[model samples]
Target: MPVAPKRMPFFEHIAELRKRLIVVVVTVVVLALGLYTWGWQIFDFVLRPVQSALELAGAEKLNILGPFATFTLRFKVATYAAIVVASPIIIWQVMAFFLPALKPKEQRYVVPTFGTMVALFIGGIAFCYIVVAPTAFEWMVAQAGGNSVQVLPDAALWFQAVLLLLFAFGLGFQLPVIVFYLMIFNIVPYNKLRANWRYAYVIIVTTAAIATPDWSPVTMGALAAALIVLYEGSMLLARIVLSRRIGEQKRREAIMAAGGDPDEIDALDA
Candidate 1:
């Protein structure tokens, strides 16, 4: 007779998390399968910028290096598309998991923050698709040294590069969401944010350089510039949104400094 396993103290949380994971995986897998069926059609749209760039550069054609490459490309592309298509559900599930941990004040921000995050990610990908993809490919083709060297790009490699840039920019565009939360949650103070602009700029530029698949200065510069704007905008918004919260915290700090009972900091908020 096999005994039943004992549940952990946090078994409910584990179960809830498992449920969310199952939903996300199922959603992605289903979409991936469907997308795989229509891959070339999708790829035609996805590779438009690269296609245009090749034409402008007078490249002969994009070639598949392997007999199995087309199938592999379709599968991979479908998986990426599925992940992207399922992002909203993914974001909602992840945020919902943390909603219970937030105070009522923070709870009100949940919907708007998640919505903004989704929009920003999509916007970032759009920017890359519209701008960086064409620019980077053109630059690359130019490096082939004119009409003497006929540019023949590998289909699999080109598609992979485009995917990397799109996702990198999308992830990069989440900077405001992160900065906004850190300020609102009092994890990082407004003063510190203002003071650390230099360090922030350095990090942003370095991240852009590393994240861009092609190492194109044009792509990196565009991403870095956009991030800098987002950072400043976030700082301004945080100053507005967190003004009252910051004031309350500072008052509580002063009370503690004047020898009030640290345990009674709750009294100060009132």
Candidate 2:
């Protein structure tokens, strides 16, 4: 038998949330400080894709318009790095907060789900860096019409765009996990998701358009295609998993109704 979960009063819940937030904040601050110590190295690593793109476009170097721009950019880089470093802890805190609300079976999925979320986020960032960014940059530069106009990107703007694009891709890749949770929690049925494919496609296209850093159709199309594939794949997996879970639940109910121990039935099967 599963033990009942402890209930907390509203104020206690607020206090727990505050404690978690504090932990997250402290972790981020510490990571940010540590990254700031080596900010230049991180900045270089982050700038590689853009630098390569600029070189391919025949640009020499990015322009720094203001004296304080470099400092600000470095700080931003550190902050972003900090967030990346602290992501696992952040995920843990979120999961911990909601664990009490989940049933035993649902709780079993939390760790795996969190792991999947992290993997998908990293995959999204890698996809953007390895494929999307380079292609988009090359395409955008090609639009300059054969050396008629020189491409001189601002250092701050360039870094900001890269960071935004990375973050966008990372978050966008959570669609499957989100869909899985919705179905698992019965917030949305599999039939409804299957029936609403057309609407989902429209939303995914709009999201891809908005999230992509470049205005080029190539990047947008690539993102949209990836999102659509993830959506369909998630739906298929959800259907299978949910069907199995429902079947098992029905079997357990049948065993209970027959006044037989489900645990004994499981042991006998084993």
Best candidate (score: lDDT):
1
Cα lDDT tens digits, model 2, 59-99, are 68778888897888788889889998888788888878877
- List per-candidate RMSD values in Å: 6.0, 3.6
91-129 per-residue lDDT for model 1 (tens digits): 888888767666665677888988999999999999989
Please list the residue runs of candidate 2 whose C-alpha ends up more than 4 Å from where it truly belongs after superposition.
Answer: 1-5, 146-149, 262-270
Candidate 1, lDDT over the whole model: 0.84
Provide TM-scores for the models: 0.84, 0.88
Q: Local error of candidate 1 at 82, Å?
A: 1.2
Question: Once superposed on the true structure, which residue ranges of model 1 sit more than 4 Å away at CA?
Answer: 1-8, 147-150, 244-270
Spell out the clash pairs found in candidate 2.
none
TM-score winner: 2
